[model samples]
Target: MSPAGAQPIRAKSRHHRLQEHVLETTTSASLLSTSYLATSPIAQQILARDLAECSDDDEDEVKFDSEDDGDDNDDSEEDFSTTLHGGAAAHLISRPSGTIYGTLRPIIASQVQGSPAVNERDLAQSRREERSLLRDNHILPPKHRRPFRESALRQLYRRIFSTKVHESGCDSDVGKALESSPLLQHDYLSEDASGPPSPSPSETDVLWDCATVASSNILKTTWQREAKTLAQYSGPLILTFLLHYSVQITSIFTVGRIGRKELGAVSLAAMTSNVTCYCVIQGLSTCLDTLAAQAFGSGHKKLVGLQLQRLTYMLWLLLIPIATLWWFAGRILANIIPDQDTAALAGLYLRVLILGTPGVAAFESGKRFVQAQGLFHATTYVLIIGATLNVLANWFFVFKLEFGFLGAACAVVFTQNLLPFLLFLYVRFIDGMECWNGLTRKAFTNWGQMIRLALPGMIMVLAQYFAFEVLTLAASRFGSADLAAQSILVTCTSTTFNIPFPLSIAASTRVANLIGAKLTDAARTSAKVALFAGCLVGLFNMTLLSSLRFQLPYLFTRDDEVAAIVSRVLPICAAMQLCDSAAAISHGLLRGIGRQRIGSYTNLCSYYLVALPISFATGWVLGWKLEGLWFGVTIGLCV
Candidate 1:
């Protein structure tokens, strides 16, 4: 018999007769457990042919056993209840690939010496008897519906093995088995055996988990199982971040072209005005990223949309303080800066950028909301459109209209504000929005419960990004030439750093989704896949940037000294890219698992308590110039 479940035929005439008889009996059987109509007249012949082959194999096995060893061949009677053991494969799924099922025979499992040599006839008979007994008794087959649970199926397999061993021809087989009950107990009994005395539940669970993981998709290649999940989210995630960060970079470039003063003001505004607002609101919205993903996975469809609505409201209120802070940014900067012009312009630009504060909060919150629902491509599409138009708006307002710094800030406001509206429209109209209900007062509630997660997530994002900007501040003391070079390098590395941003989002969403769906094995597999993918992407970025270190500086600056400094520092940044990517993805994994606070606490200690001190000490005390600052930063990233 072939392992694909086709047994060799011993008698062609009897096989034909048995096939017709089994088909007649199966056709007349009623659907029991599941709902379905009778099979069509056209499919009856094909069904009969498959069932007939199954019965032929069964009868042959019965006859072969009867002839070879003298056990009850059990041939003539048709007991339909026999199929319950393994016959559902024939009556259930109709596969186009022509794969057969329920053809499993009792495997000859005994290894004891002195046992009779099993011949082809015995193997054939064993397989045939299992199949025939499954289909023969006229005890009404189950309907085409839900399959058996893993525990029950595992028990069935155990029974099949036990039965096959006992059926062998050796007289001492039972005695040999009973003498080794300890070994049998190890395999069959749970560790914490109950009052009835059985195997431990832990051992049973382990067996079932292995079996369940093994049985997912028969057609999916073993190598493809883990990778397929990574593929689903990684590509869209990369594209989304690419489009997203482009909007910010374009804003920087458009205003940078205006003048050095305008550039400085916008940079300060980003640090002071936008960063706080953007990071805080976005971080808080990740509360939904974790919650909504689990909710969707757990089958609470409405909860996902409601969570989205709730986050939108929460962020709407969260942005009020952020906007007010930006309003006073210029005044705040004036106290610290020796140059009043730079400080006042910084304040003015922030107020302008604040024009889009609600937009940033809304869009970022909406992004997390839809992303949790696995609607990644929608975010990508909106970002692409917003990014394209943002460049044009920046060019038109800053260069064409001579709006100066305000022109750059206005473009940011318009682009960011538009994203949330566009994403909202998509959810309302698209297929995945089955969870979205119109807004309500319920969204305004859930303050304390949601804040528990939101607070840690907000701190995690702020601590990491804020630590990075500190490196920039530390570079400023090295003189204007070093500062400009550091700025270009930071921009380049930031863009390069975005390669892993998607992976983080994907990891976060995928992990939560799997956990909510009650698939812990799949969730663990996803984490492993995400980690491996992060490594690959990090290595690729490190190699690419390192190779382009000399030439890439020209893309960012025309100044020889600035470009030269960038070229020198580029390698350090490249090496750190790998670590940075891993850190980012790790952050996402933590968020996905609803453990953002651990990462938050870690970053606080690593960046402030460790990394910053190292940078300050190395850059100033050791006088290693810009390299010292980054080296210190890299050391912190390692931690």
Candidate 2:
């Protein structure tokens, strides 16, 4: 009070000390006491001055908070500083405080000087920054994110749909969605929690992808499958006809060497056996082949084996009746062939051939199963084997053993019957598959399905074979030379049509399986390829037949009269080859589509209603003779 000019050094010193204390205190402690420290530093000084000014006019005494535990180290420091400035030497040292004192001291100081308010604001700012960082890092809330993810998926589906990728499979839109978002993986590896990613595609998958060209390219381009199909089927068709030609030439040759009686018996026996057996064998084989194709395509190997077993039982049972009838074929032949002497000759051939019925039936079953695997080349090999055996056996029995017509029938029996057994054993052991698992009671129960598939084609085959046989019988009445010439021409026509038959079969199997397996693109491509293959085969055979017209007569006859007659009627035969080739291929295509009934009906209408009547009329009433009958066949074929 005496040092008037010194002017409030005490207040200034207090302010300076307060700032230094605050700077040293932790912001964590300040925040804990933020509620109690709402005033600014300068405002607290004004409040203290006001309290001092009010001391003179106070009626009541000021209350001191004696409860303050006397633990104010900061306040003591201020007092000691004040005393030093007043020319007194005083020193104070602080003792270490207890836990409560340490905790509360900073809190109390923060409240007195508004340090808590600054700390509270900093803490709030820190909380906001944390939230912003999380948002920036893609840790979005469930409600705000799910719809966005779903929208992205929907857009992806739309893009695939627009690109025509959905045409690749059945319910393709769904498949595409599943492919993108694999549900099966969800159970094993949760997408929500972080984990390692999926590995790269496998070698097989990569190869398949690389090989899979666009559907457009597959449709336009011809593949080796088609070329192989042409080679495989065309050869068999030609061979079937060639075999028929061999029968006719053998008849004429035998007649020239032996007599008409012996030749007639052999020719009738060959025709009766080949036509009847060929229909049953091919029909059943087609059904079996189609089944195998479906099973293979769908990856149902076990089911295929089971179905094959069923077919085996059904085939064996069916053969029982056929075999029994053929066993008594010697007696039946007396009425079928033209003369009693020819009947005796034909009966001997039939008796020997009938011995091979079981073998032939089994062989056909095995062949169908193999061919169904799209191994069209198998047909060529099997045919070659049979042909070789037949040729060798014929030479041995006829020329060496002097077995006559019985020798030829024995050759047919030995070769045809043995082939299927060898093929079955090879396919089962070497190829490691059971194409013929044999008959069981379980197979019989499933035979209804097999019969459902087999019957239409079987009936169609029977009708066609019967019509051809009747036409041959009628032509035989025109004279032996006319019969021989007609046989050669018919054989040529039949062989050419056979080439496209397998192509049709492959198409049916592939398309049906692809459709069943939900591979729409593959199915469509298979159908187109088959159709193209059919057309190409027809065109090629037509070209071949046209070029070979002059040489056709030399194959079957040395007689100038027969050659001249064949040359006169060759145009109709050529036309029949063209028409029949297309028809046979188309018929096969229809069968592949499981539309065998439609093909059967088409055959019925083409052959019976049209071909037969015209053939009879031209041969019998019109007096056009063999040319007229062939012309009727040509017109009937067009119909």
Where model 2 places Cα greater than 4 Å from the true spot, the runs are 1-264, 274-278, 281-324, 327-338, 371-380, 433-457, 503-551, 557-564, 585-600
Per-model C-alpha lDDT, please?
0.55, 0.47
TM-score of 1: 0.60
What are the per-residue Cα lDDT tens digits for candidate 2 across 473-561?
Answer: 77657665665566566656655654555444445434443333233454565566666666677778777766777777666556666
**Winning model by lDDT:** 1
Candidate 1 Cα lDDT to native: 0.55
Candidate 2 lDDT: 0.47
In candidate 1, what are the lDDT values of residues 1-639, reduced to their tens digit?
111221211233443453454343332121111111111222222222322434533333322222344434344322222211122222211100100010011001000000011123332332332232211111112112224556877777655442221223322332333334342234332122222222233332222223222333111111133455456556765666667777777776765455545555555566665347766775576566545543443233455666677777787887788778878888887776555676788789888876787777777667656655545467777777888888888888888888877887888888878887888788778745676656656666556667775776676556546766666555645655565566566667777766776566667655654443234555676788788888888899999889998887666445677668777888888888788778877877776676655776676787788888998898899988888888887887789
* Worst-scoring 10-residue span by lDDT in model 1: 98-107
Which pairs clash (backbone N, Cα, C closer than 3 Å) in model 2? 233-499, 234-499, 237-495, 237-498, 363-420, 508-592
RMSD per candidate (Å) reads: 22.0, 38.8
